[model samples]
Target: MDYEFGMLAWSMAGHDKDKLYVIIKTEGEYVYLSDGRLKPVERPKKKKWKHIQVRKTIPEELCSLTEETIKNEEIRKVIRRFSNV
Candidate 1:
């Protein structure tokens, strides 16, 4: 699956398994993710593509946002809504 910016990703493997994160950026075989609080946008967590399940669902709030325009608060809101936390 093509991992796009603003998409939500599910960590399928590794120590962070089952955690939800917003995609901040995508590289060759990796994606940068952030959960707002734990992994802030300023310093996103880098993970391998094979390790995550990209949801490819961009929340309405993040749909219009770019990698640069997105905020931590917005990321947190979307994550909270989806994760039901």
Candidate 2:
């Protein structure tokens, strides 16, 4: 299944038909800078982010599937060995 990610910037209401909640830096990790350490807060009822940006997607080749496959194979081998022991 295809999954998507976005930052919930703010909540808005009673706007034009084309506008709704503001979602920013969608679909990938984005570098966000804050003046101080920010923690999760209650959802605001206003539109804080006016910028709609798309984040860069990393190439799948960099995340080598070979390592994961090897790990899974090793796990299966260990499970089979213990099962027969």
**Per-candidate TM-score against the hidden true structure:** 0.94, 0.19
In model 2, which runs have C-alpha deviations exceeding 4 angstroms?
A: 1-70
**What is the alpha-carbon lDDT of model 1 when measured against the actual structure?**
0.92
Q: By TM-score, how accurate is candidate 1?
A: 0.94
lDDT of 2: 0.25
Error of 1 at 16 (Å): 0.9
List, residue by residue over 1-85, the lDDT tens digit for candidate 2: 1212222121222332222221211233322211111211122122223332222332232234321232323323332343343
CA RMSD for every model?
Answer: 1.3, 18.4
Clashing pairs in 1: none
Lowest summed lDDT over 10 consecutive residues: which window, candidate 1? 54-63
Report the lDDT of model 2 for residue 65.
30
> Over all chains combined, what TM-score does candidate 2 have?
0.19
Positional deviation of 80 in candidate 2, in angstroms?
A: 0.5
